[model samples]
Target: MNLESLVNLAGEAAVLATGGLLIGMAFGGFAQVSKFCLRSAVIEFSKGLLGSKVAVWLLTFSAAVVSTQAVIGFGSLDVTGARQLAARGSLSGSLIGGVMFGAGMILARGCASRLLVLSATGNLRALLSGLVLTIVAQASLRGALSPAREMLSELWTVQGGPSRNLLSLVDGVPQFGLWLGVAWLACALWLARRARIGYLIEASAVGVGLAVGAGWLFTYSVSQVSFAPVQVKSISFTGPSADTLMGLINSPSLTLGFDTGLVPGVFAGSLLAALITREWKVQGFHDGPSMWRYLIGAALMGFGGMLAGGCAVGAGVTGGAIFALTAWMALAAMWIGAVITHLVVDGAVAGSVLAEPLVDQSSGR
Candidate 1:
């Protein structure tokens, strides 16, 4: 399948691009309705509560994993959409980057993907965080910082792959998923709601959401024919962070990856949802110090996501949902980052910063 043939039959990259937008829209809607935040979810869970928000994350995962499993089992998934699914490289970024993104998410109020969803809901802090995230992503990809980042990764990487580490158990299903599901199940059991129509409906929706997201991402990733400089990508938060920044520009080419548009779609979807619910409002920090929090937090999330190679959805929920080993490592690091940030920064999960100049003492900033 040449690019020209793909262009004619699969509508070239048009279908792929649309699929990306759909992903953005689905998450955006989930964001608006659920107010989901992995950072907060972890915070609450650590504080002795399964709560509703955490379930949103689990329900989201349940939906994604079931859908992804269906896709792969049905011969519709390519298995290459996920970075660690079928690619080769040291899992350095997955582990280290996960910690970074996780911690930064705690500081920034949410992961990069969460920021996109929150920005739609009038959170000025998230909006500013998104900006910082974009700048750092570009810097990480290629800039003055690339050499150092690359060097550090080379120094610590070890040879590891997902060949038979856990296949001994099921000879199938991702190990990460198996463990995460166990945790999720435990939490779900504790939070068992009274049997009610509303509860069942919400649960079903969450399941559907997870299934659809994982299925689409996995399937579309396999469908990609553009394989020259690199393998096809499915769900990722780093490049999308850069692309989101590009869209903020006044003169971007408008002809880029679907990720470039997905962020905006998330925001737009959230904004519309908020408006219809009469919840839209222009809100923000109360002072310069608060603004500084937002800035530092956002920058941290971008850098962390880059280091982890994904964001909340890309890493925590998406990668974690799939039961990838790296996803598990990233989640651990993210939890560490979040806990440390909360204890060291200001005793606040959502660092109260937006657009003011950053404070230098913040974590990894």
Candidate 2:
């Protein structure tokens, strides 16, 4: 059927969006407050100062696992919608793209999600990065190099892999899948304990991560029911940034689409918490040189993510957490990309603790 026939289920989309918004706000707020930054986490780990960033990382990761699965168990796991684990999502693209994305993150001093929260927190560099990221993402989606990306996907596609949604495997034989997920949960908990995050930070990390996972499950379970059975999926920033425009301009073109859309949720969620905490702060730009640096870093990140197919949060948290091989490829690629960016820009691959508000070292996975 056509697009209009699908989105006609306005209420379902609204629920999905609402769930996503809540997740976004909580994630943003947690990120803003606890500094849940992948860039900082990695940088610090690389630099040998892995004290602070560890707690939040494990917390967020655990939350993603538990909450996402809960949504799945109820048959709400929208394997089709999230756009992350889809068959069309290429392995080579995820690997190369992630490395590039990660390297850019290392250079730009944060991951895509971190960039968003950092921009909100008055980091002019991050603000510029966000702007550049948006533009480059737009171009990559349907711009000059899109044909290249498409061709690349056609060329290096991996065989024998489950060429459908990544989450499908987990849903198929849930007994084994649940065990794996349990192992994941155990590992996250173990990491938290080992990190000595105490109670508050660990709790916060789990809270934020699980909330996001629930958003995924909500979309998969809630939105897919209609005149026709549609596949559900999770969230990712890249395509959605491209898709956000599609939603507005092409609303008439869609009968139904994935409902969870996490990026929008994070933005809205973060803002709500920020406002509630009286953090309705509006950040501004710095001087020209700083702007240039931010733009350059963001451009690299955009291209990297374009190649990788998702940002750190997309691959690292959402996909990687779900145990998608492609997601891990992207995450590794992202880290590598960030490191490459750092090598080219600052001439140092790793360094000391954070000197600026948004410039902490990288955290652990």
Highest lDDT, which number? Answer: 2
Against the correct fold, how does model 2 do in TM-score?
A: 0.78
lDDT of 2 at 319: 77
Q: For model 2, how many clashes? A: 54
Per-residue lDDT of candidate 1, residues 1-365 (tens digit): 64446645765346456556666666566566656567766776677666665666666666566566555556555554446554443357766666677667765666776676667767776677777888887787676666755764565444344541233246655444445455665555345352222464355437435634543553355355544322334456667768656656746456545565466666776677677767666666557666555666677666667666577677655665555566566777787777676556645333434323333211111
Write model 2 residue lDDT over 1-365, tens digit each, in one string: 43244446455555456556666667776666556777666655566554557547755765686667655666646454445554556777877677767666765567778776665554556656776786787777788867876766565665333553455555557645445556766776776677776776676667667666755665555544544454454556666655665566657643233433456556665555555666555554433444555565677677667777677777777776556667777777666665555555555323222212232422210
Give the Cα-based TM-score of candidate 1 against the true structure.
Answer: 0.79
RMSD after Cα superposition, model 1: 5.7
Residue 174 of model 1: what lDDT? 48
* Model 1, C-alpha of 202: deviation from truth (Å): 3.2
